[model samples]
Target: MRVQDTLKARQASIRKVVETAFKKENPPEASEIISSPHLEPLQIRDYFAGKRWWDITFQGLFDDYIGDSSACLTFMAPAGVEYYLPAYLLMAVEHYYDGGIITEDLAYRLKRSIMREDLYRMSLYSVEKKKAIVEVLVFLLKEYGDEEALEAMRAVAMHWGSDYIKAGGQELG
Candidate 1:
């Protein structure tokens, strides 16, 4: 087989493994808790137990995706790029913690959408709305973040370089 074909086969095998793992039926406890909207703090705590295990793997993938996208999208506008990373993280959390808990299809779709120009452009709401969006993202990071991830997110959020939107500007500045 050609080297490229061999590599493709290996990737497909690995992807199947990960997909099967994610698609396993959730525990009754997790499903029950996640299905209910009004969870007490203790209930929330219980629901999130062991979730960080997923975070360990997910964070590395998240970093890799972000790095690849940044390099690939260098020619694209950066006005709302920073927000996309955090928002993607938030959506991943929502997908895992709320939406049927886990599905590899969702994971794949989320990663594929990360670098789309339109996704960031869709975030170009009003200035006040953008500020609110940032605030919500800060809250999500505080809730789900580890030290390294938080620092990376903070760097993205506070970046004021040429690529980043200026303070008080639209496009999630």
Candidate 2:
């Protein structure tokens, strides 16, 4: 199937899955939403398909509910929804370095996000999150990063790497 057609189908599936998960009458657990059988297949498909596909899937997560809750979005990590969302976004950024497409808006958002102190601090707390942030920043450096973004990402990599190493984390190499 054409890439656009496949992406559209995945977008629809993501919307349905997220809506069901957030049902007011009986909301599913965060873990349930993250690991849903229905959603996982689509996530895996998007990750493997290409960055453009994955971006569309990621975009579906930002419905009215999420948009209104943007201020609390980062704090929602403990609830699992925020925690798992970045993994897909990071995969999209990583795939961009592998000849995948990243839309200009997505790239711009990433450029701005990487500069936020909260995001940088969040990465310091989890090895997975730190690694994913580093990978995306590295990819962005080669693709969309300007001098300032490159500098910021480099500082982040150095600080996060040192902290992770001190915590006995293995090198990403």
Q: Highest lDDT: which candidate?
A: 2
Instruction: Kindly list the per-residue Cα lDDT of model 1 for residues 1-173, writing each as its tens digit.
Output: 69658645644443343333233232223332233344342343242333432242344434433333222212223332232233233333343344222221233332233324354342343444333333333333443342333333334344322122233132332
Model 2, residue pairs in steric clash: none
Q: What is the C-alpha lDDT of each candidate?
A: 0.34, 0.39
Model 2 TM-score, 2 decimals = 0.37
* Positional deviation of residue 145's Cα in model 1 after best superposition, in angstroms: 2.1
The weakest ten consecutive residues by lDDT in model 1 span 68-77
The TM-score, computed over Cα atoms with residue i paired to residue i, of candidate 1 is 0.25
- Please, what are the lDDT tens digits per residue for candidate 2 over residues 1-173? 69658655644543443333332233224443333345443343233232222233334444422332222223232333333445344434433333233322333444344445464234434455454444444444544553433554545545544553323222333
Residue 128, model 2: lDDT of 52
